[model samples]
Target chain A: MSYHSAVLSGLGTYLPKQIVTNREVAERLGVSDEWIYKRTGISRRHRAAEGQATSDLAVLAGEAAFVSAGMRHVDAVIVATSTPDHISPATAPEVAARLGCAGAAAFDVGAVCSGFIYGLATATGLISAGIADSVLMIGADTFSTIVDPHDRATAIIFGDGAGAMVLRRGEATEPGALGPFDLGSGGEHSDLAAVRDGGSRHKRSTSPDHEGDYFRMNGREMYSHAVEWMTESSRKVLARTGWSLQDVDHLVAHQANARILATVAQRLGIAPDRCVISIEHTGNTVAASIPLALAHAARAARLRKNDRVLLTAFGAGLTWGSVAMTWPHLDPST
Target chain B: MSTILETATRILVDKFDASAEDVFPDAVLEDLLSDSLDWVEFAVAVGDEVGTRIRDEELTDVRTVADFVAVVEEKVGALK
Candidate 1:
């Protein structure tokens, strides 16, 4: 039996209205703006409004994706997020419901920065297995909700945003059809990037010293592992797709940092200009990084139809993944 | 002199962006390296030169260049 191919039909993204400049964070942390920029390559990031949650962003992005695709309905919804509205009742259902996708199959994927790729794989599988003809995959995270305000290391690196893609069943040979995937995780090094509390291992504390609830990252270790895993995964996917490095037209890597992207691109022999980067303004939106970068590139007309695109990401849980695709025609602004 | 030690010292100097004289055998690795990335890169560079891999756990008790050299020597010896 032949399986259907999942092709990306539309893309959309939503960044919160509250912008936090590096200078503002630097002032509070007693660091120079240049110091923060030199370290993370981030100038500013968005923080969710007081009442805005991850689902709120997801709904907006999902609706925009539907509008871009010129479709009113999808069969399933998959939200990739590290920060959910609550521990129970996954954010996908609420996001789907709000997008008028009520009664559609919905759930959440938890691969942190790599959540979008994982969600893409899950959505593709659903389409291939005939479970869904179309799926709305949203990568949304309000990392600002979990980061410590006093910790400059993380404060300078994260932002809240959401990006969505509409995938429909199509033929394998068509443009926008996802290629083979290379996915992996290193459970042993999970602590390299994580939130220590509000989980089964460590419950939320009412005590005044409940600092563990905030996100923590060992930058040096994270850099090493991120570069290693993302580079390896990108190579694996390129190899699986039977495309050489030189044949890649665009490389969209997770907006973890400028240094990591440069290292990965150098290792893969991908030219600097060929890599899509939006982190300078958006910061590291975690799971939203890949799609947001892709949409940004598309909006700028940097992406063209049939361009060979390679996507990769590394995140908490030590998760990493890569996927290859041909750029499709779409109005990214929608 | 052990070639592994010489190679390890060279890697340390390069990683720390310091001179050979500054990267003494007794120098603390954490003190010389700016961050964990430097430490990991140093280990990787040493492993590349000596044909050995350094696990993160192995570096836990290693404080000085001599400690890292000893670990490398042990791994190199085990390869023989």
Candidate 2:
């Protein structure tokens, strides 16, 4: 007859060693490095090596999370991604197996860029409903595999990386307990961002040419939608949590774009200092963005114990969500 | 000038830093605002001023300032 809250325990992140600078893609996309930086606020991004896979990144992050948590296993493993290692079998089980969490309930979640927040909401329920006492939640993606290196719009916008968090059951009064969340989707605008092929729709198509498998984003439309939805979602969650804009200690939003985060923070009346923009070094890591930002912020000490941290993200499915939490003190190595 | 067009022009001038003279009707959009992001930001700012969103579809036919102002004026009119 009690509610269990999913409390934060640890954080870890992994970025591939191969750092791809804007110059690498700009030449192909015919844009200057300064142009890419001026627009996306990215100087470079990490690209997975030829043999590397999404699961590989996830496993490394999961292991790092375990070390951060000082625990070797958990009751559940959830991998959030759009670029999975395989389509038939879910990616989580392999990630769990690779991380020595074989017996833990494992699965994959898809919400594109909002994957981390979506995974957080699901993991919180798993704890609240007593489905799992602890969960290893990971947001990982190899977007480089799906992005067209020559596409001027998307090529320089994405990077490959993974970030994981360990969550454990705790009381609501405990530090790090996640508060209310606002999760939503605008299915009507799904066409605004998508990979137009290789799915059931394309499989059933009569066309013989197998093409358009690359990720495509209408950055123009996406800009307005992302800023509006993320700001709205942030407001909703903050209201549900009974926190004012000024009460927020940090706004760790999806590193989708520097401009988007600034707009959302401005619309919400959150100060620029409170807005944690970690994408300058990593670019947009798709579903892995939030966790990566959190780990980056945590390691930098931007996050502190009992600090009110707001998390919001908008991405591919035209989905958006926000989660409120009081930061928990974790190992300095996080 | 119509209020809607004025709002559009103010956004272009104040928010996007488009020169007041350059935001007039028939002004080439590319000549006024070169960045691709400027169009979307300009639309959102105009939407904020007009109290109704300026959808992306409405901006498709926009090649010149006259064309964009027309769409904004029409959308604002429809709201009334």
Candidate 3:
């Protein structure tokens, strides 16, 4: 009887086969390569081939995570996304089916870009609440399916991908464990970025136009908010963990944008080298960004057992979050 | 200038990955598409080209290619 905190036992990621380069988008939209790369640090992105769905990507990531964790099944499964393949059925059950863990209690969580953070909190809560001994948390998105490709601003910023983590009950005193999570949101700024036309709010507009339906984002406004929220959330999480900024061995901020990540790290006085980035290859995978970045860093050996780490994200619903954890000793690939 | 029918049907087929026969020019927007997100993505793709802002208010009556085209035409005209 000693208390143990939850720890990450495994990691996995899956990217769609179809790769779209900035050059391809530039050719279509009449934009310059310099403009795309300079603005977003995105050189290319992977998109699910037509007919391939979000669940397909999630299942792959989930299976890999299970293998990495050295477990065939978990106590629970949670899928986070804004782009579920089907509206009626939750994608978690489908993911469980593919993992051969159909008996696991599964569901979906929608926090957009901060989704994985939210999923982490929920999964951690389930472990603490005694609802589960082990939980599989996944962040998967087919953001390309929702982007208005003609809009150069957003089109280059998104793609389809997924990443997952296996969380198991462990002693809170363990070196490789998840610290408390910090989360927040500003609903008032919701309009600053959103897919205005699809949700229930605009289901019945008086005018007969369809353009409101695309993702609309005020880039200038979003840029400012992203820095403010992410910095604030990260600082709060550090303080809560009683860990100084210097004590953090690795800062895995969400892969929302390379520029945003740079600004946040600079504001916190953290070395850029210590900051992890995967957006160059993934673009803004939305919900999938955090887990995807973590998976990559773990595979690359940037994250080693007992190393300190921090995760954070901001996205469409004006949602934002951060979490603190120590790097666990687990193979990223089996 | 592209015909409204051709543009709308092409967008529908391409964005939704629906068959040409599955999506007719006169099909209902909701029925022909799987969900509102699909229709919205299609509308955004089309509106981006013509520089027309097709707000949600204007999408209520769009049920067919003729309807979609008419709305786009109206918005494009308004811009003019």
Candidate 4:
């Protein structure tokens, strides 16, 4: 029989210490706590402490995952993020070096929120193809660094955090084994959500409103597209795994917003209790959201061994993906 | 129970989906049948009800319902 070769051996997460509450944001802009909560269901979000880079959080989560897995080494490291520490060298190499796992092939994936899932698929493929015996997938982002403090729309919605998972070669029969990934992208709607300035496109563009270049987005258009794409992606992944809404014990989605998650869950007919909803506190941590939510779920006792979990995410690049896997049985503090 | 605990319990129950009694004097913030967001919301709700805010750091050493009661008592005293 054909076999799946990667299993989630451990999980870990890290978020910055500072919290910017809705009330604080309200004081700066023409918005209220009620307005923000009614729309996004977010009351507060964590920001990275000063001088804390994306790599700092990634290293913390990677160390936690490695300790949990009881291993000091892995065959590869994939850091999924939109905000890398620098523009040239891959952030994964630095993260690996900090975690003391320097020999592994380290690289970065820039899929934004759907990054962890994409990273997982990359790691799984590596293991399945015998390119790597095991892989460390770290999703970290300091979204606050790129966000314009004066722009209320984006400032209140993005946070800084990291999450990680240790995936090792294992049998498909293992309970924590991951199924094939269901991934999709729509570059056509890329402008709906993107950092307008700072990229090569903006650098080359002759637009005089240069300051408008910082993370500008069409929120309304982005919302509609995100909901549609996420719904479709979730359905496709469930069907590919031969699992239905009732079969999924937990829905660990990217912590984008409460309304989007609720709409997707409602459309899928997945019970509200079956989902890990942690965005209210962390806001949208982009690539870090999924694994961060999963780590929180395990800590909260909401996730148990052998339970079927569904993870889905949609973000910039208009990239989106979903994965179905059985929760692996292991000591998180191993 | 001069409605202080009862009022607190109502807010906790509505925000946390926990039983009213779960917000008792000895209830631990982290150990309660609630999540981190629930506690933050609860603190805000208590602020609205008592006309005073309870910061997260203020409850760092508080682990049970009595600790929260002490906080409420202090708020009451400060208001008085």
- Give residue A194's error in model 2 in angstroms: 1.7
Q: Which stretches of model 2 miss by more than 4 angstroms?
A: A204-210, A332-334, B73-80
Lowest summed lDDT window (length 10), candidate 2 chain A = A203-212
TM-score of each: 0.89, 0.94, 0.78, 0.78
- Model 3: DockQ against the native? 0.02
Residue-level lDDT tens digits of model 2 in A263-292 = 778778888999899999999999899988
Q: State in Å the error of residue A112, model 4.
A: 0.8
Flag regions of model 4 displaced more than 4 Å.
A1-4, A204-213, A331-334, B1-80
Model 2 misses residue A312 by how many Å? Answer: 0.7
CA lDDT for candidate 3 = 0.82
C-alpha lDDT of all candidate models, in order: 0.88, 0.88, 0.82, 0.80
Which digits, one per residue and each the tens of the lDDT, describe model 1 over residues A65-175? 988899979999999999999999899999988888899999999999999999999999999999999999999999989999899668889999999999999988899
Candidate 2, residue A264: how far the Cα is off, in Å: 1.5
Error of 1 at A53 (Å): 0.5
Order of candidate numbers by lDDT, starting with the best: 1, 2, 3, 4
What is the lDDT, from 0 to 100, of the residue B68 in candidate 3? 84
* TM-score, cand. 1: 0.89
**Model 1: residues >4 Å from true position, as ranges?**
B1-35, B40-80
lDDT per residue for candidate 1 within B1-80, as digits (tens), equals 44987887776676557678867779887887865656766775677567666655678789998898899889999999
* lDDT by residue for model 3 (A1-334), tens: 3444677888888998789998999998898877788778899999998888889999888888988988889989999998988766889988887888879999999989899999998888888777889989989999888788898768978989999999999877675577778889889878887776655776644356556766778765576667768888999999998999899888888887787887678767789989999999889998889888888888888988788898888886788889888887877752
lDDT of 4 at A174: 91
Candidate 2 global Cα RMSD: 2.2
